[model samples]
Target: MHVAVLGAGYAGLSTARRLESRLPPEVDLTVVNDGPDHVLVHEVHRAVRRPAVADAITIPLSDVLDRATVVDARVESVDAEAGRADLDAGETLSWEYGALCLGSETAYYGIDGLSERATPLKSLSDAAAIRERFLALCDAGGGQVVVGGAGLSGVQVAGELTALAEERGLAVPDDIEVVLVEQLEEVAPNFPANFRRAVREELTDRGVDVRTGTTVERVTDGGVETDAGPLAYDQLVWTGGITGDDATGGDRPTVRADLRLTDRTFALGDAARAVDADGEPVPASASAAIRMGKTAAENVGRLVDHELNGSADEFDPRLERYRFDVPGWLVSVGDGAVAQIGPTVLRGTAARASKTTVGAGYLTSVGAVHNAVNLAEEELL
Candidate 1:
C-alpha cells in the first residue's frame, strides 16, 4: 500500500513519524515537502533577534524519519477524489491513502501595496529579512518601526525588534519607535482577557506603542494608511493573518473531527478549518496541529488495517476523532513572557521559563534531541 503525506511542517512531520510505527514494514510511506527540513515555525520569531538560533529550530527530515522516502518538491494541488497529488516539479504521486497538511501562507487581505511593502515573519528567510531591514534602519540613526497585526507572531516579532534595537545601542521609543497596531480592541485578541492584559502590560513596559482598535486600510511607501491616521515608519513587519495553502486554492476547507477530507484522504492543520468531536472550532496553533496529526495518524492506521485484512464489512473502520484540548498558551515579549493556564495568567520569570520549555519540548518530541538541548541552552542560558 502506498501512503503519501504532504508538507513537512508540524502536522505532516508528526503524522509521518507516528505512521512509521503504526503501518506494516511492506507499506510504502512517502513524505513530500517543499523543503528538506521541518521547521519549528512558532520559534522562527526568535531568529529575528538572534540569527544563530535558526539551526536549533530546523530539523532535517533524514534525521527523524526511519523508513519514509522524503520527496523535496512543492505540492501544487491535491486531487483527493483521484488519490493524486501534483508536484511543482512536474511529477504526480498516486497513493492509496493521503494526508494533506500543507499549512498556510500570509494573508495580505487585499490591502493596497501591503503584500509588496510588509515583511512577514512566517519563515527563516522572512525573519532574516526583517532583521536586516531593522538593522539598516538603526544604522540610519533610528526611526519608527511599525508592526501590522497584533497576533502572537506580530507581538513576538515586535518584542524581538525592540530588543534588537536596544542591542544596537538605540533608545526605545526615542530613537527606535516600535509601534504595534491591531484592529481588535486588544493585543492577543483571540486569547483570554487576563492573558491579553498581561501581554499589553509587557509590551508597554518595553516601550512599545500599543495601538488597539486601529485598522490598517492600506500600505504606502512612506508608511501605513489606517483608520486613525497615517503612521510613518522606516520599516514594516506584518503578522496579521494567514490563509490556507495555495494547493487548496487559498481556502481552509472544513474538516470533521476525524480530520478526513475523503474516505482515503485526510486533511488537518492550518490547511483545513477543523471542528473537534464536541463541535468546538480548533484554533490554528502549533500545539493544535501536533494533536490533530496524532489523531489522524491513528485513524489512518485503523483504515490501513481494515483494508489489509480484506474485511467484507459493509461499513468502514471506526476512526479516531480529534478533540481540541490544550493545556495553555504562551507568548514572549522582549526579554519577558506571558503564559495562560486555565484560569491563571503568569508573567516574568515563570512565564518565560514556560515558553522556553514548550519550544524545547516540541523539539524533543520530534526526535530532535540534539536540537532540543541546543534550543534549551540558547533560550534558558
Candidate 2:
C-alpha cells in the first residue's frame, strides 16, 4: 500500500499534502525530488532582485511531509506499468500507485545561441544566476538589456530589471534600455484584453520596450537578432517556453479527465496536457496546478481504498474530474501590479496587495504559516 509522488514542485507538494490527509494511515507515502525544499516557482523572478525573499518562500519538504517519506534525489525515469521509479543515485522505488509532477524545463524554441546566451528564469538557481549577471552588468556601468517572451514571466523580469535600474539611478548608464520581445500580438494571451493592456501600459510607463509580434530569429552574444531587426544588449533573459516529463511528453498520450495516464499512474501540472470539457489546454499557472493536484490525489485515494477493501471491479469508487477554473491572474511591476479576477481587472497598489494576498494564502494552504507571515512582510512592507 505504497504511494509515490515524484518531483515536489507546486503540483507535487500539493498532491502529496492532500493525499496524506485523505489516505489511510498505514498507506506509505513517498515524496521525491532533487531538492529537499520546495521553492516558490512563480516568485523566482522577484527573488532575483530580492534574494533574501527566497528563504521565506521556500519550505523544507521534511518539515511539511510528516506522514510521508522524503527522498532527495533526481528521478531518472518511471515505469508506470511496473509501478517502479529509477533515481539518479542508483536507487529504485516500488509503489502501488504513482503521481508524476516532475514539472517542466525551459524550451529554447530551436533558436540559435539562445540556450547558451540567455539566462532562463525558472528555478532558485536560475534566479540567483540572473541576479549575478545583472550585478555584473551594473558594475560594468549598465548596458542595453533584452528579454525574450513577453509572457507573464518575461513581463515580470523586464519590470523587475527596470525597477532595479531605477534603484541604481544615475549610477548605471543613462542610455541603458530594457526591451521585451514577444512573437505574439499581445502579452499574456490567456488573459483578458483589458488585463493585457494594463500590463503593457505598466511596462511602457516603466520605460520597457515592448515589441510584440516580433519573432526572435536567434540570439547572439552581443544581442538578440529578431525578425524585425538586430538589437544589441548586454543581457538577454529567455522566459519563452517549457516541456514536460515523459508520460506527459508531447510524444505520449494526453492525460485523461481523471488526470491519469495509466490506471496505476497520474500526471498533473505542467507535466501533463490537461484539458477542460471542450478539450482546451489548461493554462500552466500555479492555481491550475494546485487544483489538478488536489483532484489527482483524491482519485488516488479512491482507488487505494477500493483496492484495500477488495471491492469487485464493478463496485469501484468514482473518480472526480480535474476542474481548474482559475478566477484570474496577477502580474507585478515594482510596487504596482495588474490583477484580474472573474471579469474585473485592477491596477495600482491594490493589485500589488492582491498578489501578496494570493502568495500568503498559498503558504497557508501548504502549512507554512511562519513562512507565509515572512513572505507577507517582505512583500507588503
Candidate 3:
C-alpha cells in the first residue's frame, strides 16, 4: 500500500510526520511540496523585518521525516477521482492514497490595486521582500509608512517597522506617520475584547497611528487610498486577509467524511474544507490544520492495514471525523510586549513570555522538538 500527501505547510507536514511514526513499515509514503523547508507560519509576521528569522522559522524537511519520500515540486493540480497529480514540470504521478494539504494564499478583498501595490506577508518570500522594501525606503531617507488591515499581521508589521526605523536611525517625523488602517472598530478581532483592548493600547503606546473603523478603497504607489483620504507612504505592507489558492491545491470534487478525497486520497489543513461534528465549517487556522492532519494520518494508517488484510469490507468513511477544543491566541505588540491566551490577556514582558512559550509548544507538537528548544533560546536571548 502507498500514500501521497500534498503540501508541507502546517496541515501537510503534521500529517506526514504522524504517518511516518504510525504507518506500518510495509506501507510506502510520499510528501510532495514546492518549498524545501517547512515554514513556521505563525512566526512569519516577525520575519517581515528580520531576515534571519526566516531561517529559524523554516526547518529542512529531510531532518523531520524518517519514513517518507519528500518530493520538492510546484504542484499544478490534482485529479482526485483519478488518483493522480500533475506537477508544473509536466510530470504526473499516480498514488493509491493521496492527501491534499495545500494551504491558503493572501486574500485581497477586491480592493482596487491592493494586490498590485501592497506587499503581503503570507510567504517567506513575501516577508523578505517587505524587509528589503523597508530598508530601501530607509536608505532613501524617510517618509510615512502605512499598513493595511490592522489584524495580527498588520499590528506585527507596524511594530516591527517602527523598531526597524529606530535601528536604522531613520528620521520618523511626527508629521511623517506610521499608520495602521482596519475596517473593524477593534484591532485583532479574532481575539477577545480584553486582548483586543490590550493590543490597541500597546500599538498606540508604541507610536503607531491606529485608524480603526476605516475602509480602504484602493492601494496606490504612494499609499493606500482609504475612505478617510489618500495617505502618503514610502512603503506599505499588507497583512490583509487570506483566500484559497486552487492553482496549487486540488479543487474539491467530493471529500469523504473520513477525510479521504478518493478511495485512497485525503485532504487536510487550510486546503481542505473539513466540516466538524456539528457540520460547521472549521475556522482556517494553524490549530485546525494540525488537528485535521493528525486525524487524516490515523485514518491513513487504518486504510493501509485494511488494504493488506483484504477482508473485502468497504472502508467506513465516517471513522475519519475529528472534533476538538483548542482556543489560544497570541499577538506581538513590539517593545518586547504581547497579548495572549484565551479570555485572559497578558502584557509587557509576561505577555511576551507567553507568546514565546506558545511558539515553542507548536514547534514541539509538530515533531521539531530540538528546533523548538533552539527557537526558544534564540527568541529569549
Candidate 4:
C-alpha cells in the first residue's frame, strides 16, 4: 500500500499534493527528488538577473506537504513493469503504485563541443553561473553574448541579459551585443503568429539581435559555428531543448491520456512525451505539467480505491483522461511581457500583469503565500 512519486518539479509536487487528499490514511506516500526543494523552474530565469528571487521560488518540500515522506535522492532508472526505481544512492525503491515525473535535462543534440562550451539555464546554479560569466564579460569591456535558442526560455534569458547590461550602465548593442539564435524562421516558433510577432517586437525593442533561421552546427571555445556563419561570443547560454531524465533514458517516452507508463506506473511532465485525450501532443510548459500531474493523481487515486476495496471485477477501474486545454500563453521579455488569450494577444501593461499574476498564482496555489506576495512585489510593484 505504498505509492511513490519521483521528482519534485511542478508535475511531481502537484501529483503528490493531490494524492494526499485522495489516498486513505493508512497508505504510505513517498516523494523522491534529488533535492529537498521544489523549484519554480519557469521562474528560474528571473534569478539570472536577480539572484535574491531564487529564495522566493525555491520551496522546501517540508513546507508544502504534510503527510508525504520526502526522500532526497537521484532516480537513476525506473522499471515500470516491476514497480521499482533505482536510485543513485545505491538503494532500490519498491512501491505498489508509482508516478514518474523526473522532469528533463538539457539536450545538446550531439552538437560537437556544445555540451562542454555552453552553459544551460535549467537550474538555480546554472542561472548564477550565467550571471557571473556575463558580468565578467561586461567587466572585460564586453563582447557578444549569444543565446542558442529562441524558445520561451531562450527569449527570456536573452532579454534578461540586455536588461542586465543596461543596469550595469553598458550600452546594449554597442557595449554588450546580445544575440538570440533560432533554427526556425521566427522566435517562439511553435506559438501563435500574433504572439510570436509580439515576442520578436519586444526583443527588438530591448535591443536584442534576433537571428531567426540560424542553426548551431558546432561550438568551439572561441565561438559557435552556425548555418549562417561563425559567430564569436564571450559567453554562450543554451536553452535550445530538453530530453527525458536520465532515469527514463533517451528522449521523452510517449504516454497516453491516462499518463500511464505501465499498469501501476504513471508518467507526466517533461519526463514523458504526453498526449491529450484527442491524441494531441502536449507542450512542455509548467501549466501543462501541473494539469497532467493532477489528472494522473486522479487516475492513481481511483486505482488505489479499486484495489483496496477488494472488488472482484476483472476489468480495471475507469481512469480520468488528461486534456491540454490551456487558456493562454505568457512570456516575460526583460522588463516587458506578452500574453495571448484565445484570439487576442496582449502586450505592455496588460501582458506584464498577466505574467505577474500567473507566477504569483502558482506560488499561492502551492501554499507559498509569503513567496507569492514577494514575487508580486518584485515583478509588478
lDDT of 4 by residue, 54-74 (tens): 998999999999899999999
Kindly report which residue stretches of model 3 are placed more than 4 angstroms away from their true locations once superposed.
170-176, 246-263, 311-317, 365-370
State residue 32's C-alpha deviation in candidate 4, in Å.
0.6
Show where candidate 4 strays beyond 4 Å. none
For every candidate, C-alpha RMSD to the true structure in Å:
1.1, 1.9, 2.7, 1.1
Clashes of 2: 0
Which 10-residue window in model 1 sums to the lowest lDDT? 310-319
Clashing pairs in 4: none
Better of 2 and 4 by TM-score: 4
- Each candidate's clash count: 0, 0, 2, 0
Report lDDT (CA) for all predictions.
0.92, 0.85, 0.77, 0.92
Q: Would you list the clashing residue pairs of candidate 2?
A: none
Ranking by lDDT: 4, 1, 2, 3
Model 4, residue 125: what's the lDDT? 98
lDDT of 1 by residue, 1-381 (tens): 999999989899999999999998879999999999999999999998888789999999999998999999999988987789999999999998889999999999999999999998899999999999999999999999999999999999999989989999999999999999999999998888999999999999999999999999988897799999999988999899999889989988899999999987999998889999999889889889999999988988888888888882657888889999899999998889999988899999999999989899888988899999998888888
Compute each candidate's TM-score over C-alphas.
Answer: 0.98, 0.95, 0.89, 0.98
Candidate 2: tens digits of C-alpha lDDT, residues 39-80: 888888888788888988899998778888999998887887
Model 4 has a clash total of: 0
